[model samples]
Every structure is written in structure tokens, then in C-alpha cells.
Target: MSDVAIVAAGATRFDERIPRRAEELVAEALLEAFDGVKGLSLNEIDTLVTSYFIDARQVAEEWIIQDYIGHIPRAAFRVENGGGSGASAFYTAYSLIKGGLSDVVLVAGWEKMSLYRTLMANELIARGLDVDFDFDVGAIYTACYAMMAVRRMHVYGEREEDFARIAVKNRNNALKNPKGQWKRRITVEDVLESRLIAYPLKVLDCSLISDGAAVLILSSVERAKEITDDPVIVEGIGIGTDTMRLGDRAEITNFPACRVAARRAYRMAGIDDPVRDLDCAEIYDSFDTVELQTYEDLGFVKKGKGVEFIEETEIGGRLPVNMSGGLEGMGHPIGASPIAEIAEIFWQLRGESCNQVDGAERGLVHSHGGAGTAVVVSVLGR
Candidate 1:
């Protein structure tokens, strides 16, 4: 086993239309990511990993991708873990390289959510949950988060505007990202007044259903230096799971999965105090309360203090968060969302992001699937 690093990272514009098929979108990201590798070529890649949740077309992800991308000679695999599938695929590539299974791996995550109607697409996403308990009762993902939001507000006496602040900050940050989906500058009042989807969750609170893809090229540290001088080392990778059904969980406000995952990530990264040690973070803001809950689960602040972190968590504040505008404004393409989070951090480390965190060295990316049932945390550094 040897050290592994992300030598290249890239993504397509997160819009409703790119005129490219889902496979083509992934190919485009692979092309852009390969460009970042100085001397690396397609021949150097030893494995290919891809993730897609809404591609109703049952394409053999790795096999078809190989024929399309010119990396057919290497080993290949497809990984799925609901919305966390992207990060999970990356983890798979990491395991292969770190365990001496393969040296260079091309990992990609993609989705074509815009192809289906809103109701049908959401129903497909709901299929990821346990069918017996959650689906039978008509519990969509947003509805579960709504329960969490309601419980959180009751526990802390927090206002709906507090959740609105999450939407506002992320949307404001997205204004700087040319590839972001939601770029409009909005206010707390705007969020509060928006049409409600579930109680306490407005249209602004949910992430966009997008058509996008992202790719990252990873290699052993020994091979990384030969490819690029500026490699983003994968310092710590932590992934965990909670009860598949929301009703089975004991607490709604705190994500036990995130609590366990973040601890492992911080420990592996040698972080003593995340609030002071980390330069920035990209938590899974699929909804406003999820991001707020992450603030507590990640130990950035004490429980119930997430609302207060909102004021100081912006671009120039203490430990700037969601520099990519997060899922709320960045667009949630299911499998592609976490990969976008990774791409944002890669840019921040390279000083290339539109919303770049000033002097960011050590950064964190957190994402979960189906209302905290599946979670992953990764710490990256230059």
C-alpha cells in the first residue's frame, strides 16, 4: 500500500441542460480533469469507477464508460450508495490504490435528473429508502428533514428564519460561481415567503434537481509526483451509516452517522480542534437544517448552536463553510453532488474557485444520503 492523492478534479456546469447525454457529461468532466494532470495520459489510469443514481437506462457504468473514454485497458467498477454514491465511489478508488489493487484510478459521478418529471424523479429517489417502512407511509426525503427541522426548532426555540439564513448565505455565495445553478441573491424574507414543499422547508431550502457530472483522477503518491507537482493529498477518509429508516433513529436533530464519520476523519487528519484547525468545510447542505445539524455533528460548535454559527460561517467569517454554495445553491444531482463538493475543495486548495477560501490549506467535505442514513467525510490538504 502507498499514499494516494487527487491529482486532477473537474466538473461540468450545473445546469438543467448541457445538450450532452449522461455519459457524455461524464466524459467531458474526465477530459477536463485529465487536463489538470501534467504528464499523465489515459494509458496511465489503471482503474475506472463511476456512480449514477437516476440514470434509468441500465448502462454498465464502467464498461460503457471505458469504451467511450479510452480507458478500456484498466480495471473498472460501479459503486452506488444512494446520494453518497459519488463519495463512495471515490472511496472505492482510494481503497484499490491504497490496498495495492491499482495505481491510478479515474473516479466519476453523474446524473440526469432533469430527464424525468419532478414527481417521477422524486419517486425514483425515494426508492433508495427502505420500502417497507418509509416508502409505504409516503415519507419523501424532504419530509424526513422537515421532521428534523421541527424537532430542532422545538429543542432550541429556533426560528424559521434561522433555517432561512442557510439558504440566503449559500445563494449569495453561488452568485460568484459561474457554474452554480441558483445565482440569485435572496434574503431571509424571500426564503420564508417561498412556496412550502414540506412544513418548515420551502422551495429555497431544497437542493436543485440537476443534470451534471464530476470527475477526479487519483494515483499513488509515488506516481502522483511523476504526474503533477501540485497534488491534493487524501489525508483522511471516513464513511459511516445510520438506520436506513428515519423512524428507527432515536434523535432527529443530530446525525449519529456524521458524528462517527467526522470523528474518524478528524482523527485521521490529526485535527485537534476542527473549528480552529480547519480552514474551511463543504458540508452536505441538501437542506438548510442538515447543514446546521452538521455544524454540531462536525463539532464546529456545541449542539443547538448551529444557528449562531450561521452569522460567522460565511466567506470572511470564522471557518468559512460551503464555499461552493453547497447543494442548496450548487444543484444536487444525487451522485454528482458530493463529487462537486470535492471539486470545490480542490479549487479552494488550488486558489481557483470563484468563491475561494483565502489561504485554505486543510479543508473538509461532508455528504450524506437519504436524510443522514449514509454519510461520508473526507479531509484534504495540499
Candidate 2:
């Protein structure tokens, strides 16, 4: 077996409207990635993996992107696992390189979500749930997360204002991220006053329906040295899944899939204590409550202490989390989100992130799909 390294990463600004097709967005990201790594050519890539959730326009999106990007003759395919598609695609590319099946691989993810109305996009996202049971019962995506938030509050005595603080913290961090969708600093009062989509989650608490793309170039350890001097090594990767129906889970307060995945990743990375071992993190924050629960599930804090952990995850805290504003402020483009999370970690490891964490050497990236039914956790270090 061989080691894999991420040599270059790129992403377009996350926004409501990018004014371009998904393939075009991918091409832009690939060009930027190429610019970062000197002497790297598209022809040198032995495999291409793309990730996207909805079929906004066409099928076989990977083939379409390969044609648009002029990377023909290279093996290419698509991976779709709801919101975790991007990280799943990245894991596939890492496996190829680690197994010695390919020396160089290109991983990209994009979503042109602005093409549809908010209601229509919500409908599309709801398809990830059980069609006959959940979706047909008039369950919107927000409601799924809302139920979890309600349960967490009921069991742990957490208040809505605690969740609001998560939104404010991430939005404040977004002010430093040039590519963040919402750069304006917000307050806990602002989140509380916002329109309530569900019982506990306000409009400001939800992630934006963004349009964006991200790309990463991975290579074998031997080839990485030849391509770039600073390569972020893929230390560990783990994927886990729970029931598709949120009701099937024994506990709604925490996502078991995230706990399973994070434990595996931490063990593989030789991390006995996530809070002390990890320098920073980029976890999926589709909803502010989700981020709070993830802190407990990821072992960053003790269970039922997620609310208190908020201050500890701030910019200058013990272990900064979501320095890229997470999905709340960075914008969640479904397929592109997980890839973008890894890109943020890569930049942090290289001291190039817009909101760099001081002396960050090891970082974690987490992504979830289908109401926590699936999770992918990865550890990266310089």
C-alpha cells in the first residue's frame, strides 16, 4: 500500500448565483487548482471523480465535465450520497492512490442550486429521505433537523438561544472568509428574530442554498514530492451510515453515524483526544443545531455539554471549529460542501486559509448526508 497526498485545492466563491453551468464552475476550479501546482497537466490525471446531488440539467455529469474540461481518455465517474457526495468522492480518489491503482487523481464537486426556487430545491433535497414514508408525509428537509434540535433541547435542556450563538459565531467568522456567502457579522438577537422555518430553527440558522464548485488534485506520496513541495497527507478516512428514516434511530439527540465515523478516523489518525490533538475542524453545519450536536458526537466535548462547547470552538478557543464559516456562512452547495471543507483544512495546514488558525498542523473535515444517515470523516496533516 502507498500513501496519498492532496497537492492542490481550489474553489469558487460560494454565492446564491454564480451565473454559470455546473460543468463550467468545475472547469474554473480545475484551472485554479492547476495554477497552484506548477507543471501539472490535466493529461497527467489518471482518474476523475465528480460529485453532485440533484440532476438539475443532465445525467452522467462526470462525463460532461470531463468533456468540458478537456480531460478525455481519463477514467471518470460520479458519486452521489446526498450532501456527503463530495467527501465520498474524495475517499474514492484516496483509495485509488493508496491502493496503487492510480498515481494522480482529480476530485471535483459542484452544485448549481440557484436555478431552482427555494421550495423546489427543498423538494429535491427531500428526495434523499424515504420516499414512501418520510417524503410523502410532507416532511421538508428543515423539519428533519428541527426535530433533532427539539429533541436535543428536551433531553439536554439546551435553549434556542444557544443554537443562535452557533449561527452568530459562524457568521462572524465568515467576515474573514473571502469566499463565504454571508460575510456580514450577525448577532444572537438577529438569529432569534429571524423567521422561524421550524419550531426551533430560524431562517438564519439554516445553511444557504449556494452555487459553487471545488477541486482537489491527489497523488501518490512518491509523485506528490515531484508535483508540490507542500503536500497535505491524508492521515485517516472513515465513512458510516444510519437508517434513512430519522424515526428509526434509537436516539435523535445525537447522530450515531457521526460518532462511529469520527471514532474510526480518530483511531486511525492516532488521536486519543480530539480536543487536544486536532488544531482545527470543518464540520457539516447545514443547521446550527447540527453543529452543536456534532461537537458532542465528534468527541470534541462531553455529551450534553455541546452548548458550553460553543465558546471553546470560537476563533481563539482551544480548538477552533468551522473557521471557514462552515455551511452556515460558507454556503452549502450539497456536493461541493464536503470538498470545500477539505479545501479549507488543506489551506489551514499550509497557513494559507483566509482565517488561518495559528500553528495548525492537523485538522479534521466531516460531512453528512440524508439527515445524518451517512457520514464521512477525514483527518489531514502537513
Candidate 3:
């Protein structure tokens, strides 16, 4: 099988109310993508895979992006799997390259969420919930996660203070990242004292509803050598899903899909233990509890040991996770956030990250959708 490598990657600054068209945001990220790669160009790309969630707002925006980005005539398509859309597009390109159907592929993810009011935008996001039940009950992502947080508290003795630490860590990390959205230095007290969205989950514990774009170029290993001297290899990719309704699952304490996906990716990458094998990670942090739960599902820690992660596994810790601030502080643009995670890992593996982890060589990126219904876990190495 042919190996795939990421030759270029970039992301627009993640923020709310970005004053630019969706295609224009994509164009901005593409500039950073092709900046250092001396010989690459849009014309050389054989395919384009775009990702976005709010398709109902503007039908077939991918075609518009294709035309605006100068890939109108070549093969181009859109991918939507809620928040996992970006990595879904990525794996599409990865398969195309691995299968020899395409030599060079461009994957871009963008979302213009700022176009709608926060309430309407949330309603759009909540569309991913089981409309017949969860939506009717008015259970948004925060509420779904909050219920899980409460269960985690009863079962594992986790506190709101424990989850609040994730917010403190990720937002603090954002201060070092220029492309990250939040720059305010906050504390656990700040997280707890912030406006309460759902019980145990305050405004500070939730990810932002931001507008952004991220781009990456993928190619065969042989072709990767031509693109750049420093190529970050896509070592393994795995995806899994569970029932959309949280009530349908056997348990709600953890995402079964994440564990399944991570196991598959880890097996493919020959990873015996993620904490020992990975130098850093950028997992989904749409909520602070999600990050802690992912730490267990991804095999970084055991079931009740999540707080140990919060206590010890940050930068300069055993395994630095979310050095780019993750969705919590970096901003979650849904479709583009996973690609932004990949961009951060791409830079870290290449020793080019703004907040570089010392001697980093391998990393993991997790893309999550719905109420832990869909997950994509990928392992990256230099």
C-alpha cells in the first residue's frame, strides 16, 4: 500500500464574525498553505475536497468554493459529518492517494457560522441531535454533555472543578498561539464563575461558535518528497460511530465510538500505549468534559484516572495535549476545526508550531460529531 503524507497545512485565525466570504476565508488559508512550499500550486492539485456543516444555509457552497478557488473544472466535492466533516474529507483524500486514484489532493474546510444569530446557529447545530426526541426535549450539545458530566460525577467522583481545569489549561495555551481565538488568561475559578450554560458546564467550558477555515495538501510519499523536505506522514486513520441518541447507548460515561476508532488507529500505527507513543495530541474539546472523557477512550488514561491527566499531562508533562488550545480556546468552527487540529499537529511534527512541544515526533488528532455519535481518530508521525 502506498503511504500518504501531509505536504502543506494552514488555518485562518479562528474568531467570531469574521468579515469575509466563505470562499475568501478559504483563500486566505490557502495562501498560508502554499507560502513555504516553493513548487506547489493549485493547478497541480488533482482534486479538491471541501467540508462545511450548515449546508441548509447555502446549498452546495462547495461548488461556489470550487469556482472561487480555481478548481472548477477539476474533480471537487463536499463532505458533511457535523464536526467530523474536516477529517472525513481528509480520509477521502487519504484513500484517493493511497488507492492511486489521485497524486495530489487539496482538503479545505470552512464555516460561516457568524452569519446567523447564536440562537439560530445553535438550533442548526442541534439539528444533528435526534430531532424526534433530543431536539424536542431541547437538548443541545452542551446539555447532552452536561448530563454526561453529571453522571461522571456520580460514578467517578469527578467534580465541576475537575472539568474546569481543562478550560484553564487549553485557554492558557491559546495565549501562545497567534492563530488561536481566545487570548484571555483565565483560571479554574474563572471557568466556574463564568456564565452557566448547562449545569456543571459554564460558558468558559464550552467551545466558541466561530467562523474559520483550514487547508492542507496531501500526496503519495514519493510525491511528498518533491513537495517538501519535511513531510508529516499520515500513519494511521480510523473512524467509528454510535447511535445518535445518547439514550440508545448502553452507557453514557464515555464515547464507545472514540475507543473503537482509537483502537483501530493505534493498531494500524503499532501504538501500544498512546501516552507513551504520542508526543502530543489535539483531541476534540467542544466541551471540557469531552476532552477528559476522550483521554480515557483514547487510552491515555484509565476510566477513573481522567483527573490525573488534568493534573499532569500538559506541556512539559508526560504527553502534552491540545497545545494549540483545542476547540475550547482555539475556537470550534465545526467543519474546519479538525483540519485546524491536523494543521497544529503538522507543524508540531515538523518543528514549526508557534507553541512547539520540544522534540515532538508523533501526535494524534480526534474529530468528534454529534453527542459522541461519530468519531475519527488519526495518528501522525514524522
Greater-TM-score candidate between 1 and 2: 2
Is 1 or 3 the stronger prediction by lDDT?
A: 3
Local distance difference test, per candidate?
0.87, 0.92, 0.91
As a TM-score, model 1 comes out at 0.98
lDDT per residue (tens digit) for residues 47-127 in model 1: 888888865656676577678887766788789898899999988998999999899988888888878889998888988
Model 2: runs farther than 4 Å from truth?
none
Q: Please identify which of the two predictions, 1 or 3, would achieve the higher TM-score against the true structure.
A: 3
What TM-score against the true fold does each predicted structure earn? Answer: 0.98, 0.99, 0.99
Collision pairs in model 1: none
Clashes of 3: 0
- lDDT tens per residue, model 3, 1-382: 6899999998899998799999999999998999858677788899999899987678889899989988869999998888899989998999999999999999999998889999999899999998888899887888999999999999999998999999999999999999889989999899989999989889999998899999999999998898898999999999999999888899999999999999889998999988889999998999999999999999988987899887665789989889999998889888899999999999999999988999999999999989888899999999
Model 2 C-alpha lDDT per residue in residues 1-382, reported as the tens digit of each score: 9889999999999999999888889988888888879667888999999999989667888888999999898899999999899999999999999888899999999998998999999999999989999989899879999999998888999999999999998988988898999978789999999999999999999999999999999999889988998999999899999999877789999989999999888888999999889999998999999899999999988899998889988989998999999999999898899999999999999999999999999999999998999999999998
